[model samples]
Target: MSNTIVANDLRKRYGDVNAVDGVSLTVEAGEFFGILGPNGAGKTTTLEIIEGLRQADAGEISVFGQSPWPRNPALLPRMGVQLQASAFFERLTAREQLRTFGSLYGVPGRKADEMLEVVGLSDKADTQVEKLSGGQAQRLSIACALVHEPELVFLDEPTAALDPQARRNLWDVLRAINTDGRTVVLTTHYMDEAEVLCDRVAIMDHGRILRSGAPAALVRGLEAAARVSVASGVMNADEARTLPGADEVTDDEVSLTISTRDAPKVVAALAERGALEGVQIKGATLEDVFLDLTGREYRA
Candidate 1:
């Protein structure tokens, strides 16, 4: 399949510091791709370069077979963007804000009404931007980004600080966007969000990409062979650490994810120690891979 975006050796500097240093990656067409990193990791800068909102000091970028720099006319209308925090008229209602955004692309205002439904904001259509709650405003921002019906969409931390139910609701909306064949590029520090929403992810750090692949593949590439989790049982993390074939073990109170190359052997050892009651087995997760690669857990 052809790639929709290709960035090479992209660099951006702010005075004495490099914000995006020698970063390169490709995004396939119609795929949900995520840029995962902590704060000041160049995720936003790299994304801004691709979206044509910022200039890169060095390297190259191409989106949809055309250079994004120098303000490519053909690229703008085909793309949508939701920045870290969306700014609106504040006075306008959610529905009116979307309508105003649609007019920028020369599309009829009615399209905003359709987008409102897509984002599950139809109930708050008449509420002003300032009156809308955090979650509602976020959903409105996404709706505004997509009101023009672009082929590619950029969503930066779309669900930040949302309640659990609101975040899940927005995830469904995002899935619908991807299902319609719009290529999506998302930047987030949420491990579970990236694992569930992205088809492939690039783990970035300090202005560079550490690894890039499907989430499952990257986690598999870790030294861990299998992860045996004790869901409902409590095992002392220190005791489990010494179990046979256990290379690493993480105990989070009620659950433990034991990384081992030898699953049966590890299980036998655990059983011998009477630690198998209400336990479970599973594969390693993207979060595990992030910790192994960056030596820092994703916190957002």
Candidate 2:
């Protein structure tokens, strides 16, 4: 498959600090790819460089086989961007705003109407943008981005502040877009969303990618060990340590982190002692993998 986006040693600096340092990745055509990281992790900066909104201090980037820098007018109409922050004329209706954006992209007015329908904002087409709720506003932004029927779309936190229902609704819309064969690149802090929506994900921290692969592969790569939690009401740590395969024991629970090869043996040992009553066993999750790699720091 041909890559739709590519970067090699992409670097960017802000005064004395390096915002993006030696990052390299690629997105294949028609792929739904995600960039996952906390705030100030260079996720947005790297995306901006690829989107042609900001210049990189060093390294190289290409989008759809063309350099993203220097503002390629020829490529503008083919790409859609829903930035983290967007503005519009407060008095303009959602339809009006989409129509205006469509005109800028040389799209017909009917195309804007179609996009509004696709985003489920046809009922609110006549409502002023300022009157729309947060979710509605986000949907409008997406509608505007799609008005030109772009081949590639970039969404930065598209469902950041949405309620569960609204987020699910947007996820359906995104799935539909991908089913129609458009490539999508999204950045989000929501790990569940990344796992469900993206075909592959890249985890970044401190301006560099720590790992990148399909979500399931990344989760399975984390030691392939089942976590067995046993709660026996404040058992002595030493007593809990006596259990087979128990590597770590806490005040309230004893965790048996055993590889799949030894899971059956560990379970049989637990069964021999009637320790299955309050036990829980599960495979590693994306969140678990994230914590294991990133060390659970509180972000500002």
Candidate 3:
């Protein structure tokens, strides 16, 4: 597949701080690519650079084989952007807002209505923007972005404040967009969201990408054994430390991290000691891989 977005050694700075430092990535056409990181990790900065909203201090960026710089009007019409924060006229209805944006994009009236329906906001079309709930407002924003029938879409934390049901609804909409052959690039802090929605993900930290790959492949690469978590009294860290292939035991939690090869032996040992009580075995998840790579540091 041809790459729709490409960045090489991308660098951006704010005063002395490097907001995006030596970042490089390629997103294929029609791919659901996710950029993930904690707050202040440069995910938004990198996205803005590729969207032609911010100037890069160094390196190169291309979207749809063209530089996303100096305000390329030809490229702008083919791209859709749903920013993390959006504002709408307080008195404008959902339909009105969509119409306004569609007019700006030179989209037909029917196209605006179609996008509103696609985002599941048709019922609320007549409701004022200020009267709509947070989720409804968000859906309206998404509708506006798609009104132009863009080939490439950028969504930053699209589901951040949505309820579970709303988030699920948005996921379905995104899936349909991808099925229609539009490339999507999204930034999110939710690991589960990335695991479920992205065909591929790039994990960013400290202004750089630590890893990029399919979510399942990244988890499988860890090769860690099933994790066993027991109640506090069943076993202690010291006891778990003595088990075969056990590497590290989190203090006082009875959580054991063992090698995949020796997982059976470790289970047998626990069973023999009657310490299997409350023990639960689980496979590795994206969160596990994230913690392993990024540690448990608190990012502001």
C-alpha TM-score for every candidate: 0.89, 0.88, 0.87
Please give, for residues 80-159, the per-residue lDDT of candidate 1 as tens digits: 99999899996899888999999988878777688898888888889889999888888899888898899999999998
Ranking by TM-score: 1, 2, 3
**What is the alpha-carbon lDDT for the whole of candidate 2?**
0.85
lDDT score for residue 32 of model 2: 100
List residue ranges in candidate 1 displaced over 4 A: 225-259, 268-275, 297-300
User: Per-residue alpha-carbon lDDT of model 3 for 43-140, expressed as tens digits?
Assistant: 99999999999999999999988998988998999999999999887799899899999999888887788888898888998899999888888888
Ranked by lDDT, top first: 1, 3, 2
Task: List candidate 3 segments past 4 Å from native.
Answer: 229-261, 264-280
Question: lDDT by residue for model 2 over 74-141, one digit each (tens)?
Answer: 78888999999889977999989999999997788887788888989989989999999988899888
TM-score: the better of candidates 1 and 2: 1
What is the C-alpha local distance difference test score of each model?
A: 0.89, 0.85, 0.87
Which TM-score value belongs to model 2?
Answer: 0.88
